[model samples]
Target: MGRLTWIGIMVALAAGFSAGAVFGPVLMPRPGAASNPNLIDLSALPDELREKHRNEDFLRNEATNYAHMQEALAQRAAERAARAPLDLPNGMESVPFGLVYKPGGDVHWPEGMTGELGDALEAAKDGWVILNYWASWCGPCVHELPEMGKAAPLYADRGITLIAVNTDPMRKDTPDSARALFASKGIESLAPYVAEGTAVDQMMAAADMTMANVSLPTNIIYAPGGTPYAVFEGGNLSDSPVWTAPQTLAFLDVLAKGE
Candidate 1:
């Protein structure tokens, strides 16, 4: 072969090899292949690129699973709500008293009260207390608060006081913003309680509740004499499929009747 002809052939072969290396996965199937041809072979990528792609896939799957879980919880709450006039049996176990902080900023509390949650509970010792943990950033919590406000008066008539404990931590504008939200939603009846410092951690530990893995609303139901009888975790009937205000009220009604 002439030298020029040999050089040209070698260059052509090199170009073909490069093209095949780049597009081979998509164009050709492996022997006895069961793998998806549409999916990129991440193993062939650089270490950093592979890690990035792996992380993206993990996050996508995580989000999907979370969404599915929320839907399931909402369905469950709906089913429970359909069974109206729910009631809790008597002699239910109770949790011990734990401290919570007073709602800060311009929100008002009774005169001469030191804004200690434990003390407030002690004062209302004879009534059923619904201690709701919420935050402004939490969409489900925001949706449920208005409903809770509407139910507050009726609950109070039945000796149940709905106290919303804001769990937004300490921020310059959090309390003001929370108060504004209450005003905007016309939530007049439910007293605002702030979870500050380590109060949230303490309250969660005391109530045996966990919001670590899931960002769901949690409420603690306390029977007369400050005994925490039940802990409702996850979304409310208003937003989530896990819990409903009606169910809570029914349970309280039974408690009020000493059932």
Candidate 2:
């Protein structure tokens, strides 16, 4: 055979081998689950381009799960909402006290203090004293003050004394505003006083150290002997779920009739 003829035969053989190898995978794309054009139509890509996009969707999903950006954003929003300000008292800017419950109806008063309030607290008598620490700018105090005003008169004959302490930290406009607000609202029953100088700080310190850290609108109950019965550190009287209608009546009952 001529040399050119041999070379042509070899070339022809190589072409046939290449055609079979290419068609082998095309005939069977791994058997199970036939590729549906409507589902994942990849007819548009050449062989080299097809594999790149084959895992594109899977990679995108993996990246999303890895970052979890959407979930992080949602959590951040919730935190911000929770941190939003509540109506604080004038000259103050924090929720220093938390809710606390005392069992068995006993109150522990500050040692070495003796006065009307001190006497009432120590006696554990049926009568109850409510020490309300508030400020002019506090929204929660404003909301609760009216309820207290009404309740005070209603229970006046029952020996329930409502003392309102203004914890404005300074004799600024805040305390003045608070007093005016109370007067205008006809809160005549409250024994109002400005807790200026060190009084406010002292009370807060006492609460934190001895009385279970309390705040404005704090309702502390005592037995006749000056022992703490219960303490309610919450928002407006209407908003605090700690005292129910029946509980309120019961508390009043103890105050009015207990000795």
Candidate 3:
């Protein structure tokens, strides 16, 4: 199968895993009732105090609900595990809920890093501009790193500029650690930036949910006008077809031609 085709599969499976995790709550945190210091024993309280204790108990129950939900989810997962293998595609593992990809949102470029990257994009006299959002911790992102690096220089020679927009907030909080990780991984094409003092949720809400996921290696190709032309929503670059698929090169060619 072609690399793009594999990516398509990954996208589907990732979506499925996300759905299951959400509806199933397999990875929820179990907060035992004892963990909540504010939990009240209504039986020991007087009439007036009982009412107040009931309110506290209500809040405590909400907290414990997560724990109870987690326990239920664990039982379900164990039962499923005893059955056949998880039919998920290669290079994909189940992720927590609320991390699936949805589309139609705008890309959130950090204001500080936007100047250089945007300027680079605008400077493209001809050909398309490819902006890749990636992070080191992302598995798929790591897999795509080398190919993207190669593609960047190749596109540059063709008058197209491929700029990797690093969205890892760790760069701000731990510059040394972040830089070391990037350098160790040989991610030279990615320009690191820290999105500080900005709300990622707001930007993502304004942008497409299809672009966001719990997985790594989310890539979006933009045209010269800063509009999205194509998107590889999920899947790691190291997976089947990504390393050798001609379709990968074909898309790069399309970008080179500015189509």
Candidate 4:
């Protein structure tokens, strides 16, 4: 099958997997829980203690919900692994991958460096490239930012570069918010790129990927010469096991050694 066609299939499968696993009945609130106005019996508690009790309950509920989600995600990942191995396009083993940077788009670096998207990618073509597409609005994307930050230096030592592209629209999702998030998450090592206009759309289209169809926190792994090797989409706990830092590093190691 053609590359785009294969990507379409993968997208469909990922959507189905998410629907079955992440957004299944487990996520539904208990019957009457949402409808009941007095679910919390705080009427007898003192005013000073009521807020504390509510906060404690909120934290407890959050922890439980997060655990359930993680379990579901892990199960989905295992099911995906049992079904098929991650395979790229045929003959892509030799194809040189490179970024199709959209000219006139602004890209910002942590060190206060600013430049066009194409120039930055061209300058960093000497090593394995992990092009991560993210947005501030995506919870999973925000959660993975810190992990990506922590892994960047280690990957850089092994001749790998991690470029985080903020796909938030300039008008609604300001660059300031992106920068703030990077700083808040302590993302020191990963360079940040801001997408302008249809820059992200153009880049994905060139690589036979579509943002609308794929999940957020999408990542494109490119070999040293810029040839795209793998496209991993969805949350960190996604069925695509390559979403983890270890898996990503292992994949990069294989590419770096030409294995």
Q: Highest lDDT, which number?
A: 4
Local accuracy of candidate 4 as per-residue lDDT tens digits, 1-259: 0011112322343332222222122232355575443343445656764444445444455455555555555654453344322443333332212112221112222122245566777777766777777776667677667777877787777787778877652235566777787888788777666766677566555434454333355566666666655655555533232323464466566666776
- The CA root-mean-square deviation of candidate 4, after full C-alpha superposition on the true structure, stands at 13.2
Task: List residue ranges in candidate 4 displaced over 4 A.
Answer: 1-116, 169-171, 207-214, 237-248
Worst 10 residues of 1 by lDDT: 1-10
Per-model TM-score, in order, reads 0.51, 0.47, 0.50, 0.52
Error of 2 at 223 (Å): 1.9
Measured with C-alpha atoms, the lDDT of residue 63 in candidate 3 is 49
Q: Write the per-residue lDDT of candidate 1 for residues 1-259, one digit (tens) a residue.
A: 0000001121232232222132222333456778864545556656764554445444355455445545555654464354322123564332111111222122122223235565665577677777776676566677777777877788778887777777543223255677788999888877666655566555545444333322236566666766656544444433432222454456567778877
Give one clash count per candidate, in the order shown.
Answer: 4, 17, 11, 4
Against the reference, the lDDT scores of all candidates come to 0.51, 0.47, 0.44, 0.53
Model 2 score (lDDT): 0.47
Question: How do the residues 1-259 of candidate 3 rate in per-residue lDDT, one tens digit apiece?
Answer: 2121112222333232222222211222245534433232345546764443335344354445545445544653463244333222233342211122222345433232344444564465245655555555556655666666656666676666666545542334334554676677786765543333343332233233222222234454555555555444444443444522454455455546645
lDDT of 1: 0.51
Model 4 worst lDDT window (10 residues): 1-10
TM-score for predicted model 2 compared with the true structure: 0.47
Candidates 2 and 3 compared by TM-score, better number: 3
Best by TM-score: 4
Candidate 2: tens digits of C-alpha lDDT, residues 1-259:
0000001121232232222222112322444767743244345657754553355454354455434433444553353344323232233332223333452222344343344434533443445665665666556666767667766665555676656666553345345676688888887766556655444556555443212122345455555544565555545434543222344545565555752
